[model samples]
Target: MLTYSRDEIAAYLDGVVDLEPTPDAAGLLDGVAEELHALDRRPGEVVLVALANGAALLRCFFGVLLAGGVPALVPPGTPTGRIREIADRIGARTLITTGHPADPPGRQLGPVQVETLTGVLPQRHEPGHVVILTSGTSGVASGCLHRFSSLTRNAARHARSVGLRADDTILVNLPLYFSYALVAQALAGLVTGARLVIAGPPFTPAAYWTAVREHAVTSSSVTPYMVRGLVAADWRPPPSLRMLTVGGESLDPATAGAVLDRSPGLEFYLTYGLTEAGPRVSTLAAHREPRRRLGTVGRPLDGVRVALRDPGPDGVGELLVTSDTVLRRKVGVAEGRVGDCLVGPDQIATGDLFLLDDDGYLHFRGRLSDFVVTGGTKVSLASVRRIANALPNVIASATRTYQAHDGTRFDLDLYLYEADPVVAEEVRRELRRQLVRAEWPSRIRTLSLRDLGHK
Candidate 1:
């Protein structure tokens, strides 16, 4: 319930967002809200910021909010058609991209170039300006318009929880659109007045290390992919790094250990949550006392709650979330989280399944809907897949597919790779034993595991 006033959020900027056109921005933070208010004719207006760097998007985000407009900071890699669809679906009249200003705004585009954006507008939590959508990785692009306060509240609470200060320089690797990557690195930096350094494009390893060295970043946001990359490269993490937060996808235990081995003093943590819930609902402190929970997603943070519902005497049902940080509702879309809690006392039913141990640590299970009932009893394919994956040099993945032969849902496809066929066959047999009798797969095909390496 901590609401930000006027545009206190934008004034929180620490470094240039490094836009494509690059605004000669020095101290533009002063009267931005007022400036936009002077020209803005509507409230709750949405601004589509297409800035390159995370801070760039944030600048426009704060600019829009300060001006009384909701800022939907667009992420990188958005296709043009999707942008137009979103704009039309939301009835957006103004677009706040980079580049030269225009009257009619030229043409419609869902995919935008950062170097092409320009202009600022009034702020409001109205219908638009606020960012929408949690994980853009899902099918069809969408958004969840969050109040500036919600984003700010997370930053403030996180800074306090992590002991972040104004002197910290957050190294930015993930896009600002990724709620986890954006919130932990960009927003947290702004809230505490820390320097910002954008990480490189996805496949660029050198650029990442270069940024760390040049900017002297003390903290960073990352995922399992980056951790594996550092391990593969045998990276020597700069001693300047105080902490690194990883999420979006589960970080394999092996990769986590490898990362720690590479960088002795660097602190690592696993965060869990999605876009619909303002990114992080839980976090493991960097210096968590118990050393680190091997397969746990940690506990809920301030303003968030996690609960479990038992399906029966046999199984755990769902992981529930209740939070003000959770998005009220998604605009211009359907079939997602609707008006908070869908059932029970929990405000949000995370499709992801989980179980709380006697120790209070929550262990992640597979998606509830992902369970496959082959004979009579239902089996979690995720568990089966995880087991198959545990075999040395063997990786496993499962896909729930509809069969034309039986016209029934089945977890028929399980993709696994092992460099040697001898080992692959061993994996298939092990899977048969690991999975229940009813849970045995219909087909087990073997192929080259090198291409799609690890799941």
Candidate 2:
């Protein structure tokens, strides 16, 4: 069942999957799959798809699966040279793209074009693998290897946990390349037979509201950055939006309160996950118990178990995750744990600090690496960034620790996006008021969004 036959896809797509108002989605997917089959696609060869979010991307996705090939997905804007480099690095023989049509030109499926490269490494049998690229801040990218069955199962669990129904319209505005948008949003919508409204990124309040109102979206998800944008613009969710989920970063209580205040009836879920753990570990229904559990990331999903390793007296330690759906491995220029083969069978050390409460809720403390010793006191850089980003004027924040010029100790440097002098001063006053002396940033710099390289 890892790969579906034409008949299976036809049966499933007839009534189960409704992507936009596009006609003959099944027919288009069939055409793509048949085209790949005729293009000499080997049963277990790897294929790369770098396309934007749309019906065409979905068609190519299932088409590769139906053609009995493993599909690796990357951002649609990835350059042709970079794609070929990735293909060579990952041994992918075929590429599905919207550019650089192959010699003798492969058939076009709507806006998608298939290109077969000649210089890929030796073909590998990977029919069960679906590669997802990680958007790490570091300059390198890694493809997370996931089994088709495990990802589907994870999506089903997430959809059920969040009460996604077949009749619901789920809005996917984030980039499809991210696992949060791919596995938890798009694939979850498909697994639950829900209609999907695909939208692109560079998320703005106007575009987000327009999509929700136009499509009558019943379900949607957002990142903390998007949440801040929505709140800053004072945009309100339409009546049709019944459930909203937040991921990608920890949602501060002030911002979460603003969202909840605007839409009292909406179900707001605060979730925590990384790409390595099949991208979803826990989700908290904050709207259900906003007064009691506003800061926690809720409990684990049905099949996932979370524990703290070597917890201190305060029950804070590095968090570890165990689940059947954890990633098999990472490939091609990955850094950190998986690159070192530190991930064990059905379990991974999350490298994040957390405190499991008596009620089983997981409260995220910070990343283990984000902490630095300053003046004989441990300081969490993530905390400083979180507090600064919580301010209304600050669009985004970043923190770095630099050794003193005198080589005495480490000093903290903070960068804020589009903050004025008044706002920066307020942030300084608030940090001193709320945080301990060691957690304060030694220097604060204000820069525009363009200067910070953010959208």
Candidate 3:
């Protein structure tokens, strides 16, 4: 069971938590909490948080929670117009951010009250919890609502199951807006009384390694791109580093192997989940049978149940998960009656296709929406992207089906990020060698990271 309370978290961070390039994070958290309580914001009220990663972000997040307001964390670099849109979509009337000229104090930023926190004001209820926005990769972004009790219910068990220690120092460089960073990195570190290290933006490979070596950082969270960058730089970590977790996307077998090869003594955790599942459902601990289960994302986390729905002949099916952490979409009443109200369904259909082996390991195939049929053959866009990303200098790839204006045949369109002409040719050649003719991409276009909506 998880024991996470506001008081407990405050006590845990009383003197231990450290935010680099800043002083006394614990004192800052207390002061921010106090300032938020001064707002007299009622419980269940919506507040938009648009602060960058550092002491201010942490302070404001916990402050809103402690003040009994539902806080929605927006990405650091979100534009003013989009921030207003998000706040309006969520019915938020209050916006909290760092003091910027655009967001003047005592002035309304669009339709919301702009409350700037220059630093912790002074020092400071809780049915309403957190609101996490989806990546909006598909289209319109939706908010995933999570109760504070539900989010922290299994946090302690999760930390223990993953071998996080109180003495360990966790380095988190990911955007704090995402659930992965909020729950897995910040909350987990605080709950376990671990020393939290926050790295600022522009997380280059050199800065990451420098932080790790300088702070003797023991654990850190990473994405596939970050891992690829580390491997490309041939950077070897210090002995103090013990755990490295990879998630937010599928970890290719080659990338996983390369990570393990470089850090033989380090424990690599390949985790899998969506934002709705409090962002983590399963983790493959590399210390146990490291190479044997390179492709599998391992079993479910403690207190979480996993089952397959509609298994195919090959046993692949949609992954269904039941956990206390699953978010229930909030339904509002219209015209004196509730419309299509659900009693909080026990299981969430992950919309992810997976196959569980007899040994109980789960292999992620791809999202059900990511599969496309070309020439009567089903091809996984994720599979194609994985293959394309394996090519050298390829940052990332996205695949979709396209058709000519006057053509009948459906063709695969592959978008490669940060790939030069030579790298694009190599990707095409490699894809031809690895995939069937029907599954080969019809068009491969190189694109900038901005073109793909990545920062």
Candidate No. with top lDDT: 2
lDDT winner between 1 and 3, please give it.
Answer: 3
Estimate the overall C-alpha local distance difference test score of candidate 2: 0.72
TM-score of 3: 0.72
Q: 1-455 in candidate 3: lDDT tens per residue?
A: 12356677666555333445443344545554455566665566766787777655676677667666677887656555445545555566566664323434544322223463322221111345787765321112246678766766545656766799999998878877767777887888776778888886556889998888888899898876677778889978788899998777666788788888878788888888666676688889866765879899888898888888899999999888888788766311111111111224656776678999988889988665554434322344555565566666666766655644311133434456644777667767766765545456676676756766777
Clashing pairs in 3: 33-124, 34-123, 34-124
Score candidate 3 by lDDT. Answer: 0.65
**Model 1: how far is 348 from its true place, Å?**
1.5
Residue 334 displacement in candidate 3 (angstroms): 18
lDDT of each: 0.58, 0.72, 0.65
Instruction: Kindly list the per-residue Cα lDDT of model 2 for residues 250-355, writing each as its tens digit.
Output: 7778888888998979988998877778878999999887556878889999999988899999999988899988878776665443354335678888778899
Q: Which ten residues in a row have the lowest lDDT in candidate 1?
A: 108-117
TM-score of each: 0.69, 0.76, 0.72
Q: Where does model 1 exceed 4 Å of error? A: 1-11, 14-40, 99-103, 106-129, 135-141, 286-292, 312-315, 335-346, 368-455
